[model samples]
Target: MRPTITGLGPLLDQIGADTGMTISTLGVLAAVPLVAWALFSPLAHDLSRRFGQPRVLLWSLVVLLAGTVVRSLPGPVVSLWIGTAVIGIGIAIINVLMPSVVKRDFAGHVPAVTALYTALLAGFGAISSGVVVPISHVELGGDPAGWRIALLVTGGILLPFAIAVWWWAHRGRRAHSRSASQHGRTGIWTDPLAWLVAAYMGLQASMFYMLVTWLAAISMSTGRSEVVAGVDVMVYQLFSLAGSLLLPLVLRGRIERFAPALIPSLAIVGAAGLMLAPGAILVWTPLLGLSSGATLGMSLTLMAQRARDHDAASALSGMSQSVGYVIAAMGPVVFGWLHSLTGGWTASLSLLLAVLVLLTVVGVFAGRDRYVLDSR
Candidate 1:
């Protein structure tokens, strides 16, 4: 998730200042990984089949290291773009393969392992977003490139994790084998239920991302100071962590059709709270955070649970994330455009409400106890 951290608010502005990149250019920089995820995600299944999941994971870490170095090295604008794209590509591979890895290694311990996985990703992101400003204040070699140093420090912290993954890959080289015959005839894309899963993933993610983009502004609208509004965002993240940690217990074995619907109801409740109470973000932020975290956990868990095996897990992960994320990436942009056009938050909130309804409808189908391989 260093890739996600690298694109945080403080880091984005610092990178733009260091490289003379405009806001529009910075938006593209931020979007690079999502686009790369959409493009490269499906390939992870093929790559894993050929080289093994562990090996592919190891190499993706290597790409992350290289891209992290190149990206935050106080380079030219072009290098920044290239490095960001490289980092995005690396994360995309890991993104698609990790849930599959959980399916293979912790088949019996799915909930616990999935919670740990999701928590760590979100945790790192929160730390990065909060620390980048402070990190920017620190001088590295007297370079004053605090943003650059901040990213490098984050990447360096990942070195131990990379080494561990590499060790795992080298040890497991011959334990893996590929068999195309194992895959069922149904591609993930053709399944109606799979689309519901994808829609659930995308809509929830889009709502989360869209809220993250404007949460502070929304807070400030109610007369909160910038500092307080920022704290509100952090509070949302903390409760989100709580949500992920707890939701898995609720979804340990088979899922009910209403499990997914439960998550969006949190969002809908929070939205209603905001509209009804106004300026009382303190009251509803936690519910919204829990909804975001729990919803994401459900989506990731479904990627593994719905699959018949690691191959199917990878395929489902690839299809859902690749397509789902591309859809999610448009959310903030759409909201911003709506805000600009309507000159208020009503239109955007209305859109958010509409998505919540759609997600609820889709989650009813996605949350059913059906397997992806059975779709055909």
Candidate 2:
């Protein structure tokens, strides 16, 4: 569900052409959601408290579907921004609340369920990237509106299941905010480890969004065709899926260990490869995929493990993603502008390499064996 918004990043070129916008303008489409997530993430706890998490999730799906329809509508550039922003807002709510649900429901198997969530997200995201062009051309019978058709069809498939899940979960449930602390069980606002977690999340999210937006185009710049480049993106996701599945076995629920450092370090190495040898995408793609996927799995796991209870999970999740996304919101726009300014890929790729380095350092702090509720 979250990956659907991300999948749109790789289609920026097509969107630009259709909307008669520049690359810089199209970059906004990718970053807009992050910005919205930043703004909306902190509000999740309040809404869930007032209306129940299950019901809130259903409304999120409804708004998400509406955003898709609005984006697919034939209109000027404004519709794209409006629709994308709406989509981002919906995703924000889900992102902030889902961790609490997982922490409460699957408390005994945090890493395993985190892995499952990552796998689903990465798998569908890869499918979205790989199929958009084919679905546009073949599924839509060569219509000029193929991209729009593809978006609608994908949303159509996901919406029903999303609705059913929320509907089932909401049975006999009601809002319960009468006596709960408004700030959740603890105050993570001043915790240094909390800041580290947010930094790790922001940095990793920046790199991930950058790849989703530029991977295919970057590969294509290396003399590969669009289809082949898209396949490379799929291959990356497959490796990511592997990493996600492996993370649970690697550390179980204990994340604050020396072994986890290898995850983001691997991403740093692969990112260096991307800068130096863009042509060998097949080689570096797996490295990035594996490490990035593991990093994501850990991030979600940490959101749960770093909190002692569901209330604290809600607080920490809201804080981590909100601040982190605000930091990440600049990635696509800055990356695209760098490419435009330099007229080459080297500068942009180098910047991402720097981000990966910072991601590794902060991830270590985030992986520490402490909970937000245990702080001073």
Candidate 3:
């Protein structure tokens, strides 16, 4: 999921060259999966209830692998869009279930576990972003479509291994034993606090995806090479890993209320830096990455903490991510459209700043330690 989100940044130009598509059109490619995420996220809890989490997750992995293969195949442009949507659907299921797993398995250690999960997400995303371009440069099989191979490697390579491990971990487990009655009803959709969480999730997700999809283009627009721009994204993701790893420490004290707002404030500085000093990308990219990583961890932690149990966590997770990603899916398209409309990145980046401001404001309220569906 991270690879699909972040790895494609550097390769967008090459893909555009191969497909004869404009950058703005390709921005829709980035959003396709996000749209799938929004559409499919809400179904995860129901799926889990029917087949159990492990089985559903295993099936999602298979779907993800298939999507990766389909999208990477060399042929009709429609395959790319189709495969991207499939990948989005697969990830959307996993995204909603992951928080529930943390809530169930690690009950008391939500923040710590979420931090580790998000840190690894950023770490793998960094590797994918950094290496996909260089991998495309490798003359494997004398393939002219090196970008396809790069996408395959980054997106599908580990899926088989993951599937094997998952199956082995829960081989004979009774997946179909769980019933709807075991998980109580949840009114997450109508809850104002849930909406706050969803808003924060959506806003942060928009900012993250916007950067994932366009930061390389933004860097290249400033006269950097594709490889250099890729490196910038890699560095940004590495710092995001750092931020994720550091979040547990930051949240250890009584600063929970302010941490949400405080962390995203860094993104304001980063977005401003991109606009004001495009030359100093290295300086600002880390700030953006850190903010993104920490805020993501915070958001996931909130999903877990704000629920009474794993069932509620899954429900809230599904709801928040479903609504959140609808908002997120718009980010890249809007950013690209803005750039195409204005003929520069200034307006596009200003949009990001405006998003960051909204993110900060929402984070303040969402960060309050309150459980969803709690009558208190």
Candidate 4:
């Protein structure tokens, strides 16, 4: 899932060269999957209810695998766009279902489990971002277009193994047994707390996705070589991993109350640093990375922690991610458009900083300990 977004950063130049698409167009391409995420996320809970989480998740993996192949195929540009949307659909379902799974199976250990998975997510994303360029430079089959193979290897290779592992793990598990009667009578969409969570999710996700899509390009624009820029992205992801690992440890007792707001404040600092002092990327990158990872972990945790049950968790996850990715899908395109229009990154970085401020405000309210749809 991470590779589909982060891994594509390093390959964008090559893709542009091959497709003759401008940065803004490529930004739209980058955002296609996010749009899919927004569109498909809402259906995941219902899909899981009908087919069960395990089955729906397994099918999603298959869809992801298929999308990976299609996206990597050497063909018309439309294939690339279609495949990306397919990949987004798969990931959207998986993203929404994961919280419910954790809520159901790791009810008492939500933070720890969310941390573990999010850490792995960041770690793999870092690996993909770091390695894709080098792999694309490799002369496989004497083909000059190594980016296709790089995309395939980075995004497609482990999917089958994951599918097998998932199947084996839940071979006989039944679908979620909860019925409509088990859910809150009021819709999760109407709950103020759920809206707060969704706002936090959208804001944080917009920041993360925007950076992953353009951070390497932003680094390269500063006169760094492509390889060095890729390294910068890797560093960002590693720091994100560190942040993910550290969040659960720090969220104990009283600290938990302020963590949501505090973490986004750190991100605001990072974005400001990037805008004001672009030369010190190494310093700012880690700040952004840490904040990105921790905020992501916190958002996922909120989905589970604030839910009354796994059902509510699914509903909350669906709503938050659905609304969240819609906002996120705009970030890269708008950022790229700003850069294209202004001929500089000042406006683009300002856009990011402004969003971070809004995120911080939403996080303050989202941090409260409350369940979705609760009358209290």
Candidate 5:
């Protein structure tokens, strides 16, 4: 999802008659997944229950691949929008189910699993952004259609992972059945803790997407070259991966209460860096990445810890992701619109700082080691 969407960095200039649109406009297009994620969030569990997770996941990958492949085909702006929407739908399904899978399969290790998953995902994002231009320029026969080839590579890359997931599912059928039967009575949607989990997920996602869609542009406006700006974005994500990996290890035993306060503090620094010393963003970007990535993993970890059983975990994951995505989907569009109206990124940066403040306030409550039920 990150690669497919964030890869727009190089293409933004190429969009629409080789005429460049503002970063805000590009942000709107890049953020389409937010809408799809919100819409698909509620259905993740239903789809899993109806077809089984393995089948649902398998198909989601296929859909994801198809969406990217079709978008790569040369066409007009409308076709690009259609392709983007399709990719969003595919990614939304995958994102919702991936957490539930970890919750079920690695019952005792949500933090570790989420950390690793996010780290690798962030790494993939880094690679995608770095190579987007190269792939478009050198690979795929060097045609404008080359962009399609570059985009399609991600879908192809996912095939092996999808196949492995299929194999893993075949072997885990017995465990899946047992877990399903056990969680049959309690519904996750009715739980208050579930709402907290979802809200955290949405808010974190909103910040991440907002940055992903605009960070490069922000750098460019600050006088960085497109290459440097892209590299800066890649560095941000690499640090995000590192943060995701390190935080779970660092916070493992220290999170006795409100460990989530760390997220907001980090966000504050990031906001300040973006607005105050745009040149020093390279330093601040990693701090933001670390804080945000760690928070995301922690949020996922909380879902499993809070839920009483696998069913509750799945339900919570779905609810949180669904509602969270809806809230998140608006971040890019709103950020873009705000920027367009203000004529500079300062207002947008300020808006993001406000978001970070909210994150900190919520993190104080959400980060407590006590389970969601205890808070209630």
Candidate 6:
């Protein structure tokens, strides 16, 4: 995710320089994730039922590696789309299964562990987004081969995970085959709490993806260097990292007591930062990050909090992510389209503010002291 995101600014630059594509044209690269979601979301659950969750996690990375390698291949515009689509499928699988992995493996430590995982994950993403341009500028051999080097870095990062999984499988890890142990079924899709969680997930995801793809550009428009814009992106992500760590601690004793107020307040702060503070972006960026990070961490934690056990967690995870990501997939494209039509960032930023307002209202419902309707 970090690699894909980090590469976006440079990727767009590369495409524009080489092929005369516009930002909108390059943004279409995001469509690959949506297409994969539509194609493979149904398959993820079926595969989980058959091969089991851990195996699904392991194999997804293998496929992800293959996709990354193929993306580096030299070709015309078709290569970018095809490569991205393959990568999207791989990411989708991993995205759906990770929550299950967390529920099963970490058990009672969901909040702390989820925060740690997301922080580390986004931290790397932050680093990647900030550096991809510089790295490409310095290391790329010119022509298409430079893009290949950028792609290779991601593939290289994924290598160790594959090796570790292989090692763990050979050692006969027992957790891979164990079934999720929760009792009672409350058909999650029909539950209102599930939808609330899904909405929270979707809105947060949409906001983050849209900003990541555009924030550097946004800063650049403000007369900052791309490097400074990249650093601003990092500042936002760093705040996210800090918020993840801090919010979990803050919510530990009072998840049920304070969550409703806490979650919406965070979203409100983020919305303010994004929509209302262009002049003070240096200050607002980290504030936005902190708010977003807290909201995101809390949202994931709520999945475990609302579910009765690991089975419920896995099911809710699938439902929320499957639905949430599809919604999220629309964000960048929509924002870009709106930007195109409006001829500037103002209208698009306003639309996002509206989304955040909606997110806050819905997040209050999700963060309430209630379990899934099926659970209790």
Give the number of the best model, judged by lDDT: 3
Model 5 pairs in collision: 72-148, 198-320, 258-367, 258-368
Off by over 4 Å in 4: 176-186
Superposition error at 133 for model 2 (Å): 1.0
- State TM-scores per candidate: 0.86, 0.94, 0.97, 0.97, 0.89, 0.89
Candidate 1 C-alpha lDDT tens digits along 126-158: 565555556656776875646767767755566
Q: All candidates' lDDT scores?
A: 0.73, 0.79, 0.90, 0.89, 0.73, 0.69
Which portions of model 6 miss their true places by more than 4 Å?
139-145, 161-170, 174-186, 255-257, 264-267, 270-277, 373-376
lDDT of residue 63 for candidate 3: 94
In candidate 2, position 304 carries an lDDT of 89
State model 4's lDDT.
0.89
Ranking of predictions according to lDDT: 3, 4, 2, 1, 5, 6
Could you arrange the candidates by TM-score from highest to lowest? 4, 3, 2, 5, 6, 1
In model 1, what are the clashing residue pairs, if there are any? none
- Point out the higher-scoring one by lDDT: 4 or 6: 4
Between candidates 1 and 2, the lDDT winner = 2
Selected candidate, larger TM-score, 2 vs 4 = 4
> lDDT per residue, candidate 3, 1-376, as tens digits?
6886678878999999989999789889999988999999999998998899999999999999999999988879898888889999999999999999999999989989999999999999999999999889987567543888899999888889999999999888778635444333357788899999899899999999999889998999889998889999999999999999999888867897788899988889999999999989999999999999999998899899888888889989999999999999999999999999999999999999999999999988988888888775
Candidate 5 lDDT, 139-196, residue by residue in tens: 3344444556666674356655765777676755532333364232244556666666
What 10-residue stretch in candidate 6 is worst by lDDT? 177-186
- Between candidates 2 and 3, the one scoring higher on TM-score is 3
Name the runs in model 5 displaced over 4 angstroms. Answer: 16-24, 139-146, 154-156, 164-190, 254-256, 369-376
